[model samples]
Target: MRRVLAELALGVRLAFAGGRRGWLRTAMATLGVGIGAAGLLLAASVPTMLDGRQARTDARYDSPGGVTVPAGRTTILAGPDGQSGDNAIRARLLWPEAPGAPLPPGVPAFPGDHQMYVSPALRAALDGPDGDTLRRQMPYEIVGTIAPAGLSGPHEYAYYAGYQRATALVEQQVAWRVDRFGYPSLDVEAGAGGTYVIVAVLVATLLLPVAIFIGAALRFGGDSRDRRLAAIRLIGADSRAVLRMAIGESLVPAGLGLLLGLLFYLLIRGQVERFWLFDVSVYSADVRPVPSLAVLAVAVILGLSAGVTLLGFRGVTVEPLGVLRQAPTWRGRLWWRLIAPAASLLLLYPVLLGRENVGEARTGIGAVLLIVALIPLLPYVVPVVARLLPDGTASWQLASQQLRRNPSSSTRAVSGIVVAVAGAIALQSLFGAAEVERSIPYDKADPAFLLQARDRTSTDAMKQRSARFEQVSGVRAGTVALYTIYQKDIIGLANLYIGDCRSLSQLATLTGGCEPGDTFTAGSAEKVITIDKGEINPAPGVRLAVPAKARKATLIGSNAQGVASAVLMTTIPAQLARVEPGFVETRMFTDEKPAVVAGKLRGVAAEIDPLAMFTAMAPEGDRFGPLRVALNVGSTLILLMMAVGLLLDVAARLHERRRILGVLAAVGARDGTVIWSVLLQVIVPVAAGLSLAVGAGTGIGALLMRLSQVPVIFTAGTVLLPVAAGAGLVLITTVAVLLPAVRRVTRTEELRYE
Candidate 1:
């Protein structure tokens, strides 16, 4: 114990000395780790929080009496190819039956006869020249149920109404109020769910890898102190004592770092939480870490592990006599070539085979595999490439030869570069691919004018304008469809005006190029109107037994993501003839650019605005805001670290080979030659490393494309731009770190041993 304590004291002193000497480098490394840890924590925390909240919300729906929805409203979504010519469907608010029970689907059941529910079929025949059911034998699924007198009332005589009546209520609600235009809303009642373990797991996952990285960086200082360790060894301190000292060295600082990291995490937690895109408020209240107690313990263990491991390694392989005789050339097993390639291949194969559900696992596997393959191979490759450079001017030649002779030094030099290049290339690839997929084709379909109305006053004017506009332009007259929103009652429904039956055939082509006069056939007197996926009553592809007298309709199509907007595509005359006294009209289709007619529509309130309302589109120039900042900051720090590592290796080599470089200086080699040789050596290996990084980045993007629902395209700018930036960063970092060291060597006196 006494011996161990003494070693601990010595280690603590040495660790401080190292920190004091290398404060800048140490701080930079710590910052790098902190940022990475924070980012990871934030990412993990968001998804965890969202999933946790969703789970709790889902549990609330499993309560005793079951959930309650609006009364008389059945069928969650309209089916594709369903009955048309009736009124439109609207979204409704849900009310739960019991604490845990889900809200049933239907019209809101207020206890009173003051509200009237009417079928949409009542006005269908009056509105158009045709009306019919597309199908006759379709069953209805209950979407929502209503209980009278709220949850407190006793059972009373209750009546159920048809979809037509329900739709009428929905229309009234929208027509009487403006709330129908509000963004969709979702509310949940959470029960006594357990503490959020998901948050803990997420935060831990984010921090753990960072902790491991910190541990690794901490190991570097521990390794550097081995020379001092040998001194103690020579002074009759046993190998175990030296090991203890190393352990003590790493633990003390790592403990400090752990403390700092935790504090940083806490300090930024609030800001981080807001931007997390997930709700983790539950975790913030639940998870409370003990004041550095766990961190201290972990630090101590890591220190001991690192110290003992390195001590054991030295005991087995490092000879004191060899150290005393001359500085040792860095040694590594050459078999890493075989091991790295094989392991990399193995790691990559799984990623290729991984399914969508296992995506995160595949990413983890790929990252691990790449690290394993890259780190070991870098040392060997760096040296061979360095050696192959032309041996010229004295400084360059000295730098090159010095690098060639020191494998450990080269490894350090390239570490930061590898990390920086990898990140830059990766981000470049991802964003580039995303951009390609997102940019809409320039010649997209446009709406000439959209007319919005609060009631029937604008329908006739809209119909007249539709005809006059087509006649004046000498183009085929476009169909005039009516759209309305009713909000005068307890329920709300959006209505569409389905125009000429022929326009129905062009529905699929609306998103692209189509012949204008395709015909859509409806059975009997009803015109078959195909609704946009979002505008459909029920979900697409299901049959709906709408109350259209004897006719039935089936849902034929649907948009995958929800409604962009509600649309009605029917004849103007048909729509006008059936207009309700109170309804809103809106139009959204045209071939003419609204910008050209902006002056013409300035005085017209009913003129449809040509600009599509995009709720989430970013403005110009800021498209790369957060992503660019993150990518650049992360890349800069890592690449800079890598550059520093290289310089450190070069410095160490220069220090060890002072005699060799001095002899070369005496041999008449020019300073320029020396400089070139050194730069060339660095340039060669780095180039190879860069190539590998670029290749890996390209491959990762391709893999993402294969795995994602959206296509991930590879563009020249995405691939090349980041690579160029990486190369530039390498040049800058190398020059910044090495110039002083290089200059000092050139000016310093050559050593002579006679």
Candidate 2:
């Protein structure tokens, strides 16, 4: 034990204070390990982020369920959820049944009628420049901020306004009576499963690349390290001593890397709070790394570093004179390379067999296995590509010769890129395929939109609002329509549409040229509506009597607002002179960007009616907006990180070859030839790796979709994105990073230093 510790301690000292060469090795190893550790650390925080947010939200669950708790002195009534601009407002107007009622989570006491408790995010929004609209909508003074214990996330917009009366709220049926704030934990609704699946795919996409890159990072400068070990052997050190020293050196940097990863994750977490991806954002506090996974991540990184170092010495013997490299016999074995492809097929058998209702776990497993399968085969593939290259210029031959002589580092450096591109592509394919399952009723990009007031408001008020919307830019046309219950000397209820002749014509087929006060009834009205006399009440201050001579019209079509109904009554202002019609719907067609138009409309509505909501009226549109957002955002980030690794790895490989480059310049090779030679050296392997990744990614993605019971969509954008990105990285590295090193190595000073 002492002998081993002494050797390990010696290596640690040498790594820290072991001259420039030792520092380079440490940098290479530390950077590679740290990047991977950071990815896994971030992935590990997912459960904490989700579960913690869910738990806090659950604690304050006040929605009225199937069973209502009878109101008492300890009970409170809460409700009237609405929105201000784009921010969703959980409007909680609490009316305590008696004094000293049990307060909601995070509230210290019951607020006065004019005061309310707002979440931190809501408070910030209220204080911002855009708060004018929100302030008018809520019309309450802020008394306190909701504590973190009562909120779902840091950026959630919510408020608890105090009201003295529960009478109005209860009658409206929007308010729920509850004696307590929280209920028992229940399973997440099925609607949330898509988000979970997206998360699982994202993790799988990142982990495989991270794992491959870490291995590549470890092998960045393996050649120099092996020679150093041989030199240590020449100094009377036994093989066991050398092995322990190597492990110690690898371990020290790997450990420092863990600290560096933690630092990186913390810095990133802070920046993430400033922005949201696909409506998904987390507070720095909520994103705590799971303790068990954090520990496991640390262990895996350290273990892999030591394990890779140990493997580096497996087939090679270090002698006093020099190191004898005994290459592995399986390096050229076609049989071994085929195993990866075969394994991938086995993992995807269920999907390939056209099985239905395959689990999400299988989709995730296939994505991982597909990317990982390419790694082992990369070593075998690179050499074959080199030998098969067409004979061309001297630079080509030189690049090929180098690849044939030493393909290990080239293979390792390209592995990360291969796995990352492939995995992201596969994940995207799953997204495309699974997207079919969402029952998007309308076109997502359609400019047609509608605004419906949650509360009952007059048709005149709705027409004024619609006319105001027309004045706003991008709104080509605006039509106001109302859907209400039509009852007159009737025992039962029937659907009714009240609109002008021009607006009513768009919804149903009329018998004659429509005019104001012209009442028409649909063919279905006689069957569903009864003729018996009964007292009917529709809206306050509004009474209706069906016209004595109503014409029959055919129901032709429906508008964006779904206004096609059994009874069509074009009532002029004179018939219901005092009626303030509730249930008003307005449709708008926009010529500008729908989102921008929607936001403007929201601002417009806040001033007119606070309870109004602007919803896109696309019948064939994207219903799962959030799921697609989180998926694409996560996939984009993972690919970018992988590209960074490739840049550093290639730069290191070029810098390490400065000696050989200097020799070529000393002999008579031009700068162009030397640069091109180095370019080919990296590009050959990179091109081959990228080709394999694209093929595997596409195949895996199709398989993933099949397994998940979704249509297989082969999108060119998703497949080619990684390829273009990888190719761009190589060119950028060659022109920017590698070109400088190549020029510097061409000088005589580079030769003199060695």
Candidate 3:
């Protein structure tokens, strides 16, 4: 035990003993592992962050999804919260029943008379240069800011305004009496299936590659390291001692890198308020890493680093004279590499084909397996591609030969890039396929406008509502549909249908169109209700000059107004125009973008009808707006990460070969040949690897789409986009690493060890 400890301590001393090269390897390992650590930590924090945000929100409301309380001294009248659609302001009116009524969290006291309390984000917006429009809408006296405890995030927009007439608002049904705020805490998933899958797969995509690179970094300066180990072997230490020393060397950097990553994650949390994505913001305190996941991440990174370093010494013999490395052979390792992908497909086939309920987490597991499975295929793939390259020149022969070797070091270094790109393509395909399923073919256009109201029997108010509806943008015209009752039946216009020639024509067909104030009896109204064809008294003190003979017009097949039966009176007689309506509707015929128009009209209608039953006759499927945004951002970030990892891996490999290239140059080899050889070494293998990546990604996406019960939406663009991106990555990595590789190869000192 003591001897083993002595050797381990000796390895640590030797890690930093070899000047700049040793320290550079350590630094690179730290950075590589650090990146992976940070990614894992951030992914782990997502669930916790969302829960904390929900908790804060629930705590602030006193009762989440509110309940009405009995009017009492300690009760407050509150309600009618604003929606997120317009300016995202959560505007609410609060009227305290007594001075001792409990207040919301984060609020020290109620605002002064005629004053409103706003969130910090809201205050900032209102005070900014472009707050004029909002100010006009909310022209209340601003007394102070609502503290953080009352908000979901720093960017949330909310305001609590004092209402003087709480009783009147309660009576109007706009506000309700509540003894307290908020409800019990609800534990929410960061996102349900789509969201969770997106986040998880994205995190895995980025992290797996980083893990590969960390292993590569840990084994860097290999030639220098072997020579040092050879010296130890000469001094009577056995292979076990050498291996322990190697583990020690790798452990220090692995440990440091993981620790650095944890520190970086904490720093990110400290400034969490400054960050926002997918239209979401979180508080600093809410961003916390799950301890179990964090620990696992550290363990994984450290284990991988040490393991890869240990593997580097495989099949090498250290003698007293020099270190003898057995030739790197990967000739017959194909079968094992195929097992992972085969298993991955098996796991997913049940879900996609049989429609089995294996659960979302299991599918996520399948996706992750499929994404990294390509790494195992790299060795088999590279040789096949290299054989296709023309070996007409010295550089071509050299590159082709290097690829044919498929040394373990080369394989590990390139694995990160391959996995990253494969994962990206898979993610894109999944989204596109899901999109095809979500956005079904356009349904037959159902009416977008249908407003309902109750016992609103005032002619002037109904007319005014119609006029306001016309004011809504895109509304071509507006008309009032008065649904009168007969025999207490609540079906469509049972008693009367009165409108002018132009307005009533939209509801039903009229032969040659009649004059203004026309009247018609159709549906049940025709059979039961009787109308005199003269000046008749429909109600006391309300007399209408009825038509001598009413025309029976045909109701239109379908319309924006979702009514089964209509009076089809294209024109109401001019004399009966003043008849009051029993129940009213300001129906709208809006242009394209009916949703926007409908939303604006809803706000407008709220002035007259506190509870507006705004319903779209036909439902519109979700467009995956947030999913698209997340994919765009995630793709961009992962691509950048892929590029960096590829660059570093290629860099380390180049540095490892500096001695050989320097010796070749010393023997009169041309610099151009060396540079081209290195470039070809990467390009040819990557070209083949990327093709496999695309195939694998598409397959994974197809399975996910099937599991989601959506049609596969494969397009030329989906396949071609990842190809273009891979091509670009190769181009960028080539430009980034070439000059330095050439400089190192031509350096006189690079051949010192040789």
Candidate 4:
């Protein structure tokens, strides 16, 4: 144990010595690990934070198990449909007989009868300065406020009234049904299946590039450390001692980085809480990692750093001579690069082509595999591409030779670039797919004006409004359809539309032909009417006889709507036909703007909904706006990370190549030649990786769209933008990182080193 302690002490001393001598390198390495650790901690905290919020919400809604029903059942409020009315408030009555579960923190207990508690947002809306303008159906006394968690969405306006009044209201109304019965023990689990899978994929996509960046950073200063460790082995240290020393060296930076990461998380936790997850902001206290999880994360990061350090020594022998003689000539098996991608394609084709029954999990796995396949090909392809570069100048030749000599290192430097390019392509393809607009093809012209009433108005009143609308200039035709909510003896919730056959035919295409005087009934049920009206049986299709010049016609409900649905159209007199209280839709075909036509009819109608009309209209595609924005932001960030990685790698390489460059300077090589060589060294591999990434990314994106059953539409902009941006970034970054290094190496002082 004492011997182990001595060795550990020596290792720590060596680490401190290295840090003191090369503080900049140590700082850069520590910064990279710290950023990665912070990112991982933040990523891991998302699920935890969201889960905590969900639990709190469930506790608020379900803790006091009660019988809950809509407030409309007990009250005869105007426009009780909960839509398009000033009095339309979505209130729930909860009767808490016995406490089932404990209420969530910050939520008060249920209020007494006639006393109500409203959501905070609702309270703001009702008690705001303009609250008086918004009329309520009933004046209920507000006693308390419900926290945001008590409601489903931030914008939801809801009221929770006492149980006794709620029961009495339901009994009196005899219309509204109880929506939910919450028990104390009932756990309301959020819906999960495809949504969770998509979330997992999104999270994975976000972290993969960061992971690659961090791994590449860990390899920083690796060549220098290997040589130093080899000297220690020559002085009688065994392989175990060498391994222990390497682990200790890595852990020093990793431990400090972990602590720094934790501090970063603490600093940013408040900002994180301000952001919404699952449509609600989580409590600040809930957005923290549990003690055990925090410990585990630190342990894992430390262990990973140790493991990576160990892997760097994979092929290196402990013997000093063997390590010193090692060179970059060892090449990976080039042929093996093809296997992973080919196998992934083989597995993916069946699913993409629909030959296999696959779920979201399989599709996500296939996508992951496709992206992973591109990584292995980099080392093999980069060198081959370098060999193909035209040998225009001595600098180009030198750059190409350098790339061919150290393809693995070059590949690692540009791996993030490849991944970022691929992600951009995939995201753009998804955007194109989602932008496809779906519509039912209609051969007839659309109605120029469709004016819907606030509530069910009389047929006489609708006729008067339609007549007034038609009187306006450029109004060639107009018609009114009175719609009612009719409970069919068997069919439930049927929207009954009553209108003249001739006028209705002009507005919409009828399945059964309609003439000026013909009265016809068309619907799903076979029998138009049944004798036992009290018995609720499924409505069957009915073929009603056409009444010659009939004054009235009544048709039962149908399963289909629009042109296909069973509608009763007749020459019914406005005064005789029953006009149930519902929406009165006035359709008009006119050259005037809908707003103008609406203005003309407003005098005859009780209300007019706002309408702003423009002269010309262009159809826009149904683009995935939010997804596009997210992808654009995410891909741009990843690309930026890749740019930084390129810069770091170039800086590291410049240090490694200084002595060789100094020798070249001593030989009288031109400064311009060396500058070009430096640029080519960075740009050549990047160009190759990017080209391959575009092709592979496009293919993977197409396959993913196929797997998701979404159509792939390749636009020129989507293809060109990523390519141009990637190339531009490469050129800019290469010049930025290597220009000064090239100038420094070409200096006379550098030559003196040789």
* C-alpha TM-scores of all predictions: 0.60, 0.78, 0.76, 0.73
Q: Which 10-residue window of candidate 4 scores lowest in summed lDDT?
A: 611-620
How close to the true structure is residue 520 of candidate 1, measured as C-alpha lDDT?
26
* Candidate 4 residue lDDT tens string, 618-726: 1112223434565677777777877777777777777767777877888888888888888887777777777777886687667656644456767777776877888
lDDT of 2 by residue, 1-754 (tens): 9988999998788565436645765775676677778877987898988887777778888754657666675455655435544356677778788665667888888888868999888899888986775576677889999987877766678888886665465655545677777876555534332334445555656666667666666665566666667678767787888888888767777888888888888887887666554334577787788999989988889888888887776533434353423232234667876776776677667767876555656655655666667887777778789898798998888888778877776666667667767766777666665554432214432335666664444446545666787887867543444544555444433456667676566556788778878888864455333222222354323345567677877654244233333677675445343433345666666655454455556566656654455565532233334545655575466556555655666666666667677888889889989888878887888788888888887877776565444567787877887688767765675577766666787775667653
Residue 240 CA error for candidate 3 (Å)? Answer: 2.1
Best model per TM-score = 2
Global fold similarity of model 4 (TM-score): 0.73
What TM-score, to 2 decimals, does candidate 1 have?
0.60
Q: What is the C-alpha lDDT of each candidate?
A: 0.42, 0.66, 0.65, 0.57
Off-target runs (Cα >4 Å) in candidate 1 are: 18-224, 278-317, 324-360, 387-404, 441-576, 579-629, 636-659, 747-754
Please give, for residues 308-352, the per-residue lDDT of candidate 3 as tens digits. Answer: 765656533424343434244556478898888887777777666
Q: How does model 2 fare in lDDT?
A: 0.66
Worst 10-residue lDDT window for candidate 2 reads 527-536
Worst lDDT run of 10 residues, candidate 1, spans 611-620
Score residue 743 of candidate 3 by CA lDDT: 71
RMSD in Å for all candidates: 14.0, 6.0, 6.7, 7.8
lDDT score of residue 337 within candidate 4: 77
